[model samples]
Target chain A: MEKKRLYWRICCVAAIILSIITFTPLVIPQGVSKPELGGVPYSLWTSFVITVLLVILTYIGTRVHPGMQNEEEDL
Target chain B: MIFWVWVFGLIYAGLLVFASLRSYKKNRSSEEFMMAGSNIGLTLGVLTFAAALFSTFTFLGMPDFFRINGVAAWIFLAVSDGAMVFLLLWFGYHIRMKVKGMEFRGVAGLISRCYENRLAGYVFFLSSFLFLIPYVGIQIQGIAIFMDAAFPGSFPAWGWSAGIVLIMLIYSEIGGLKAIIFSDAIQGLLLLGVIWIIGWACLSHFGGIGPMFDKIGTVQEDLLSSPGPQGLLTPQFLFASLIAILMIPVTQPQFTTRIVVMKSMKTMQLMAVSLGAFAILVILPTIFIGMYGADLYSEYGRDEFFANAFLYDQPDAVAALAIIGLIAAGLSTTNAQIFALGSELRGLLRGNENSIMTKTKIGIFVFSVIAFFFSIIVIDQLVLLARVSFAGTGIMGPMIILGILSNRKVSPAIIYLSLTGLIIFLLSLGGWIPDMYFDIRLDLILFITLGIAAVISHLTGTKRQLIRPKTKE
Candidate 1:
């Protein structure tokens, strides 16, 4: 239980860090620069794809549970 | 163009009414009606939290903030999500255990019981009631404005606002929380679909984000930056805002009841993480779309940017979709707020379960009527109304923190301390306090007050008394 709690905390921290990093380029007020994706600023494109990725991750995460529920027992 | 929007709006309204009526029939007892029998599973709980969290504020204001403020608004999601997770893991679970079989009459009741302080609970109740009605009024106003924008001549703002209030009252009065939650899930899904469609259409219109940001790069770079136009928000402000955002779910009576309704700790955890993740998906797109709108329509003023851009120049389909999304957001939030306020009032009246349920119905009716009336009066600046509502609730943060600390036998003096802190914070915002106080932000004031309150509580040795576990009735 302790280990799982630590792992979740680490995951949350990592996610926050990743969010900060992804957020960095935009925060530096150099004016709205084109997002560079391999040579193209993937501004909307990256955001769209990242949104898709986040949605998928959320769906999967919601579905996975350690000892979630037993339908028969509740019934 | 407007005809199609009217059709969609009418259909959505009808569907909401049907759902409410159905849920009302299913509500056999007060427990079933208010808390969904305390058997809400992971899926429903998550959906409820996400739907409740997104509301009209996120639907309309988020994109507007993004357009005016830039990426700084996106940080709110991160902070709010973190807060939700922390609440579920630490505070929510304990609160659930503490109040295990008892129906949370309201946040006031819970806090009063928790701290053994009836006066404190009453104060919380009064504050919540004072703020929530205006808050609901803002939502009703949002719905009216959206209707006006979408359907124009089809329905007057007053008529549309009344219709919305009527529909919300029907479901809320009938099914109570069950009706609200079920409808919220549907609305949540619809809003999500609307978000995707708008995002996709905007992307396609701009030929993609690359070209869009390229335009932004040439026009203004700071639009993509953290603090954006307002040099007002600093790192300290950001931290404070994040903390404030976290406290929202905790302080909100509507949200806490959802916490109470969950089946188990594991379900609560699942719901929290899922709600956070879903929020990022559903809400972030609206912000991006707003950014896109900013780039597309650079001529407009900041406040009118999002509404004007989407309504004026966009393709008919895109305009329709945006309007639909906005309506869904507004309605979802308004319905929940109405129910929440109703529940709070019912608790304050100290009515019996059946009486409380009936009073709750009447409360929803009265609240909706007031909100409908206010919508007409404040139709001009819905966004400003929304902000004022948020600031009103901001006073609750310190009070809530003090309440929680007081639970641990912290001094009642902490309540006064936090109240003083809130006053100073608000005054500072109004420029009543000179800025020379080491540039202390409002958020900083709250933190310092809380810290002092904590120290005083500790020194006074007024830690909370542990209650003996009572047997379930």
Candidate 2:
């Protein structure tokens, strides 16, 4: 049950981050000279960067499970 | 036009055959063959997952979408990656635990046993088989299309189809999943290289990204917008697409097998992250290539858009490389699909206790034949067919999730709810009823049906009764 709770918490945090990234353009006004890199919009790059960071954080948090210690035994 | 393209293809096919035979020799038991003795580590697991996700669809169809719609096509990359991460976090651990000490011959068997219902298992097996065959067929057809376009005069479409299928059969028959993964790792790397090169070339030709988009801004401003044309990605559609993407890994028999194949939860988690990164990086270029192609085509007519705009007048070398890359992507995914279907069918026909080698060989033969026939006969629009098939799986997602959450003993009431959801979705798809009874998308109608089913299942204590633990002797 603790593992399940931790999993859900991780999911909720990630989902919140994704939602913010996906919906940011709706909040930001258009006049800002957000430099376009490689034909991709600046807002998109921002969102992608945030997503990458979230992914990294989630990966680290999830890996703390004690079950992971028995990795070598699986082989 | 390019002799080396054929040479490369032929050599690749030969290697696949040799690897397949080697895998067959190494496979001593069903567990060894099906799940790689449950010893796969992060590298191979991540590679296979990325390869499985990036298919002919990404290679051929993505470029077309980019050419037609511009940058919005990149949404798929996020969708695919996000879906993988979500699945890994939400369900991967439980799946690993459920099949930890067991030899799960197929996803259907795993789910059915969990739900304590042979009927559900059989239905899930049949549904996966039916829906997945067309997907495999599309991959086969994609290979044929790429070869036809690349070689032009030398290799006919049928020859290309036959050659790819033959190669797939050789490895799949011999090596099972192991051979498939090994080849897929190589193919995935090659695909990444090819797409990067194409993206670089396009940028170089266009005088960099800013100027390219500046040109596009003059024509279609909506192309640059988030919602995109006609709000094709309305909030509801976006939500549906998200749900569809999340549910896909769970419902897909091929993907679920990956869960069973990994040696440990740590490997699975590592695989999820690595695969997510690989998928994102590889797909980013495809979107750029699409946007580039779209810009080029705006000057030319849209009819000659994807193939002609990008490669029609380019040098033979570049065109041929692009063709080979596309074919590789298609064949890699197609081979995996064939293997998956074969594994599922083998488990159903002879039970999970059968010899893996013999079952795999037979599966190869059966699936290859089905793929060949379906590719030849299915004359409908490929994209439409793919979408319809994906939507069909949506109906099964609820049942699979409920079954898993309930520890596999799903209430009959939940099963009835699942059936009701399936019916509504089918009705919506077939146009038996208009979508807007009072301005609602038909998909929402089905989702509502699913919600009601869940409520009824909850209120009536259906889950409690169905999932009650059995007394031990």
- Using all chains and alpha carbons, the TM-scores for the candidates as numbered come to 0.83, 0.86
Per-residue error for A48 in candidate 2, Å, reads: 2.8
- Model 1, CA-based lDDT: 0.63
Stretches > 4 Å off in candidate 1: A1-75, B301-308, B312-318, B379-395, B398-407, B422-437, B455-465, B468-473
Candidate 2 per-residue lDDT over residues B185-300, each given as its tens digit = 77787688777877777766667777767766766665664555444544455445555566667777777787668766777877777866786777677666666766656555
Top TM-score hit: 2
Candidate 2 to native Cα RMSD, angstroms: 4.2
Using lDDT, give the best candidate's number: 2
lDDT of each: 0.63, 0.64
Q: Clash totals for all models, in order?
A: 15, 4
DockQ of all predictions against the true structure, Cα-based:
0.20, 0.29
**RMSD, one per candidate, in order:** 4.6, 4.2
Worst window of 10 by summed lDDT in candidate 1 chain B: B379-388
User: Per-prediction TM-score of chain B?
Assistant: 0.88, 0.88
